[model samples]
Target chain A: MIFLKFLLYVWMVLVLLGAFFYAPLAKGLGEYTRVMYFHVPMAWITTLTFLIGAIYSILYLRKKDIRYDYYSETANQLGLLFALLATITGSIWAKMSWGAFWNWDPRETSIFILLLIYAAYFALRSAIEQQDRKAALSAVYDILAFVTVPFFIFIVPRIYSSLHPDPLINTQGKVTMNGKMQLVFFNSLLAFTMVYFWMLKNKLEVIKLKMKLKQLES
Target chain B: MIKAYYIFRKDLLQEFKTRFAMNAILLFAVVTLSAVSFAIGTFTARQEVLSALLWIILFFSSMSGLSHIFVKEEEAKTADTLKLVASASAIFLGKFLFNIVLLFLLEIIVVPLFIALMNFNVQNYLLLFFTLFIGSFGLAGGGTMVAAIISKSGAKGALFTVLSFPILLPVLVSGISATKIASQEQGWMTAYSELQTLFAFSVVIITASILLFDFVWNE
Candidate 1:
C-alpha cells in the first residue's frame, strides 16, 4: 500500500511537471507543437487502455470471472476518458494551427468515431439489467472494437493526406526528437501509464467492493 | 447457407409487405436532400458538392434501415423467437442483407433525384455502381452490428446514428473517394485497387460481426 501511494505521488508530480512545461515548450516549438506533449500522451494512453481493456475482456470471456469483467470495465471507462481528452486537446490544437476547431480530417474524424463507438459500449452495458449478459456482450464488443481501432487510427489516416502529423514514435529511431523534448516526451508517457494503472486499480477495487456489498445484502 | 437465405428472404418479404424500412429510409433520404439543397441555394453547387450531398443522404438513410431491423423484431416480440430458431450469425446476415438491399433501393431513387436536382452527371456508371455497392456493404455490415447492440437501449433510433457514423467513417471516406474517381471516368485498372480495398473492408467487418454476434446477442 505504501509503495502504491509512493508511485501515485510520483505519477502526480510527473503529470504536473508535464502540464506546466507543455505550454512553454509549445511556445518554443510552435503553437501546434504544444499539443504533442498533452494530446499525444492522451492518444497513446487511450490506445494503451483499450488494449488493456481488450486483454481483460478476453480473460473475462475465458474465465467468466467477475473480477476480470470489473478490470475490463474499469479500463474501458478510463480509455474513454483519455480518448475524450485526446479529442479535446486535438481540437484545441487544430483551432490554433488550422484555424478550425473541427475539420472533418481523417484523423480527427476517425478518433471522434472511435470515441462514439466506446461510448456506445458503455451505453449498451447500462441499458441491460442482467449482469452476466452485460459482461459477456460488452467483452465481445470490446474485443471487436479494439480490432477496428488499428484500422481507424493507422490505416484510414494513411490512406489520405492528413493535417495531423505522422507517428512521432516511428521505427527509424524516435522520429528525430531533441534531447530535452525527448526527456519531457518519454517522461510524460511513463507518467500517464502509471496514472492509468493507478486509476484501473482503484476502480477495480471499488467495483469488487460494491459486488461484495450487494452479495452481503442479498 | 440455406437457413441464411431463408431468413434473408423472410425479412425482405416482410419488409415488402409492411414497407416500414423502405418508406422510412426513402422519406428520410428525400427530406435530407431537400434540406441540403435548400441550404446550399445553388450558388456554390458543384459536382463535388452534389456527390457529398448524395452520400450524406445515404448515410442518414442508413440509420433508418438500421433502426428498423430490430425495432420491427422487438415490436412483435419476435426477437426472442428469432434468436431461438436462428443462430446470431444467421440473424446478422439476414439483417445485413436486408440493409444492403434497402440502401440499394434508396440509392436507386435518391441518386437520380440528386443528379437532377444538383445537375450532376456520372461519367462512369459501372464504376460508380461498383463503388456504391461495396461502400453500402461496409455500411450495412457495421451498421447492422451496431444496430443490434443499440436495439437493447431505450432511445435506439438516436443511439444507432451515434454509434454507427464513427465506426462507418473508413468506408465512408473510401466510398466518397471511389465515387469521385469513378465520376472522373478513370480506367478500371486505376479504380480496381481501391475497389479491392473497399471489398476487403466489407469482408473483414462482416466476418468479424458474424463471429462476435453471439456474445452480443446472448448477453
Candidate 2:
C-alpha cells in the first residue's frame, strides 16, 4: 500500500509536468487539451469500477456469499464518485472546447445515465431491508446496468454527430495520438488504475472492520 | 409453458374483473394527453417534438402501473404461493404478456385521441403503428423484469421508475427518432436504422431478462 501511494504521487507529478510541458498543444484545444489528462482518466476509472462492481455482483449471486455483495456495493459507490468527477471535469472541458457547460453530448448523456444507474442501484439497495434479498436484488440490478454501458457510451454518440471531436479518439475510430501525447495518456491511465486499486483496498478493509465491530457488539 | 399460460390467464381474469392496471394507465394517459394538447394548443410543433411528447405520455402512463404484474401478487401475499406453484420463467412470461397487453390497450386509446387533439399528423400510418408496437414490447419486456426486481422492495413505485429510466432510454431515443421519421413523411428506409435499433433493443433486453429472471425471482 505504501509503495502504491508513493508510485501514485510520483505519477501525479509526472502527469502534471508531462501534461503542461512535455505534451504538445494541439491545433484546436490549445491549453484546454490538458484537461483531458484528468477528464479521460476519470472516465476510464468510472467505467472500470462499474465493471468491477458488476462482476462482483454476478459472483455474489452465483456463490450466495455476502462477501461478494460487499465487494459489489462498495465498488458501485466508488464508481458513482468517479462518474461524478468525470461528468464535472468533462463539463469543464466541454465549456472550454465547445462553449457550453453541458451540451448533452453523447459523452455527457452517457455519464448522466450512468449516474442514474448507480443512483438507482443505491436506491434499490436502500429500499430493501432483508440482507439476502437486498444482495440478490442489487446483484441483478448491477448486471443489468452494466449491460447498457456499451450502448450508451459507444453506440449512442456515434449515431449523432453533435459530438465535437473527442481528445484521443475521433468518431471515425482512428487514433489521433502523437508520440508524446500517447505517452502521457497511457501513463495517466496507469496512474488512475493504481489509485483505483489502492482505494479499493482501503474500502474493503474499512467495510471488513465495520462488520467485525458490528459482530462484536452483537 | 402451460403453467405460465395458466398464470397469464389468471392475471387476465383478475384484471378483467378489477381493471386496476388498465384503468390507472388509461386515466393517466387521458389526463396527460389533455394537458399536453392544452399546452401546445394552436401552435405548430416540430415532428420530433410531437413524437417525443407522444412517447413521454406513453412512457409515464406505462410506468404508473406496469408493476401490477408482480406487485399485486406480493401485495395480496400470493408471491409465496407463486414461488411454490409456478416456475420463475413462467411468472416472468405471465407478467411480460400482461404488461404488453396494457401498453397495447393504452396506445389504441391514446393514439386516436392524440391525433385528434394535437393535430399530430402521420404520413406513414404503418410505420407509426410498427414503432408503437415494437417500442411497447421492449418496454414491457424490460419493465416486467424490473418490476419483478423492485416488487420485493419497500418503495415499489419510486424504485421502479428510477431503475427503469436508464435501461429504457435507448428504446425511447430510437422510438422517438423513428416516430419523427414516420410523422414527417420521410421514406420508410430513412427510419430503418432506428427500427433496427429498436428491434435489437427488444431482442437483447427480453432475452437477458428471461435468462436472468430465475436468479431474481427465485430468491
lDDT of 2 by residue, B1-219 (tens): 888788889999999999999899999999999899888878878777899999999999999989878989889999888889888888888878878988999999999998888888899999999999999989999899899898877788877888998999989988998998898885799888788888888888998898789988888
lDDT of 1 by residue, A111-137 (tens): 887888888788768876777777887
TM-score of chain A of each: 0.88, 0.91
In TM-score terms, candidate 1 sits at 0.86
DockQ of all candidate complexes: 0.43, 0.72
Q: For residues B1-219, write the lDDT of model 1, one tens digit per residue.
A: 677788899998998898888888899899888888788886756666667667878898888776788777877888898988888788888788878888888889998888788767788888888888888898888888887777665556666776677667677777877777767675787666568768877888888888878767766
True contacts kept of each: 0.44, 0.63
What is the alpha-carbon lDDT of model 1 when measured against the actual structure? Answer: 0.79
CAPRI level of candidate 1? acceptable
> What are the Cα lDDT values of the candidates?
0.79, 0.87
Ten contiguous residues with the weakest lDDT in model 1 chain A:
A22-31
* Candidate 2 ranges with C-alpha deviation above 4 Å: A166-173, A213-218
